[model samples]
Target: MKTDTVKQAESAQINVITEESKQVIYKSLLSALTIIAISILVNLSIRVDYVLLGSSLGETSVTETLQLIMLAVASWSFFLLSKQKPHFAHAAILISGFFAVLMIREMDYWMDMIHHGSWVFPALAVTALACAKAYQGGKGTVNEMATILQSPYMKLLIGSVILLVVFSRLYGMGSFWQHVMNEHYVRDVKNISEEGIELLCYSLIALSAVRTHRELKR
Candidate 1:
């Protein structure tokens, strides 16, 4: 009778733990949605879509700068997540490194470095090292990482990010619309769409890292 009671107690504890995990995940997902929404709203307001607001979309402007900032945030968040959660360390490293590269590229340093003829081997070497590190630790595989990150909220976030890449600000370009719609004149709303989408995407990445970190703390 004592043995049966102990087993029942253990099973109940396991269930409680599982439910708590689920709640954490759900909260993280809500955070993701909030981040995306807030980013979009802020970007839209600043760009003023189609209205002349003297945005940086005219040159290699505010959009790139914003992207760089968000990438930095994402990278930092991933680094924190990696330290806090060993099981996700590999994925965190991979993502953090990628965002770092993206942030650098967005700043146009790659072009200047190449122009000076000094950007060849180092970039490739760094990339290779990062890839090796990501695949090194046996705590988790890429597939397992994907599985852990494949909740509905994450799926929505991923879908939006993919759309931002595939469709891009190209959809908002006047020439693109003119070419497709057979119109003579169309107005491109500066960099509103591009920057807005980028803000949303990077915010999602950052929020996901924050969520993981919080969950691990528990």
Candidate 2:
């Protein structure tokens, strides 16, 4: 009877593991498809005339809207993590605040209406507030931050940041674009390349944030 019970328990454990694996696979596939679909839709919008492609990937374009949506998803996910998982609150505050700054940067075209480069002031203010919140959390904040940095999702998060801060900027350099387009250079083409990569990076970051939170919740 003991041997039979052991075998049955092992079989049940295997089944559970298999089911969990399938669920992870399904979610990964779905997330990838969603990102791909958004890319396609944004490019399609450029040809629609009504979607405002005159600025190409500018503030009014679908690409910018989608980038904001992706960043919003990431920011909201981190905010929700702070509320739902108190232990991670400090790190979440810092992360979500950073995303807020990115959102502010994206809206700089309008921000300029208030004052040229006004977005920098708000971004700096938010950074200060986030740091203050984390400081208030004391040693717990530092420990939680270490935990977050050690998370597997950190790799993806860092990769996305590198894509946004390094690869995209270098790839989108005006000199590179000018060299490529030569006499036929167009500003919209450069914007599309840079902004499209940014959108992809944002999607990755958002997906990483959601997956990390789910893992932490478990």
Candidate 3:
């Protein structure tokens, strides 16, 4: 009887380990597929920008449209996170508001028609309201935000942000383009390169938002 019990326990533990290893492999495969799909979409958008959009990588291009869509998805995901996780509501609200501001900034050309640099007004309003809400949450707000910032999703988000705000801008510098292209320098080519990178950054932000939301659910 004692020998039977020992064998049963060992078999159960091995089964458990096998199940866990399967799950890890499944998740890894899924992530790999997701990355490949995103890369394909990014490449297709370039063709859409050039062929269908008259080679104009301007505000009206497919790339910019995709950027808006990705940001909107990210903002809505964070907003849902706020609703689902009440303890992290304030932090989520602040993050969603930040994405909202980015969306607004992307529409600055249309906003400019209203008034020069009119996008700043709404962006400032969102920032102030989000800050106030987070402040109202007090110390808990800081703790929640810190918890979020420590996650792998946050690392992805931060990396995407750096790509969008720092690396993309520097890489897209007109001076750099002029030096590289010399006599062949074309504004449309530069715009396409910069906008494509921005699209990828926004896509990553959307992916992180989705992953974070799913993680919280689990």
The alpha-carbon deviation from the true structure for residue 200 of candidate 2, after best TM-score superposition, in angstroms, is 0.8
Per-candidate local distance difference test: 0.62, 0.83, 0.89
lDDT pick, better of 2 and 3:
3
- TM-score list, all predictions: 0.62, 0.80, 0.90
lDDT of 1 at 30: 80
Q: Least lDDT summed over 10 consecutive residues: which range in candidate 3? A: 52-61
Please list all clashing residue pairs in model 3, or write none if there are none: none
- Of the candidates shown, which would achieve the greatest TM-score relative to the real structure? 3
C-alpha lDDT of residue 158 in model 3: 86
Model 2 lDDT tens row, 178-213? 999899999877876777788878878887888888
Cα shift from native, residue 98, model 3 (Å): 0.9
lDDT of 3 by residue, 68-146 (tens): 9999999998889889889889999999999999999999999999999999999999999989989999999989888
Candidate 1 lDDT for residue 29: 100
Which of candidates 1 and 3 reaches a greater lDDT?
3
Best by lDDT: 3
Off by over 4 Å in 1: 1-41, 48-53, 58-62, 109-126, 143-147, 150-153, 169-175, 178-190
User: TM-score of the candidate numbered 3?
Assistant: 0.90
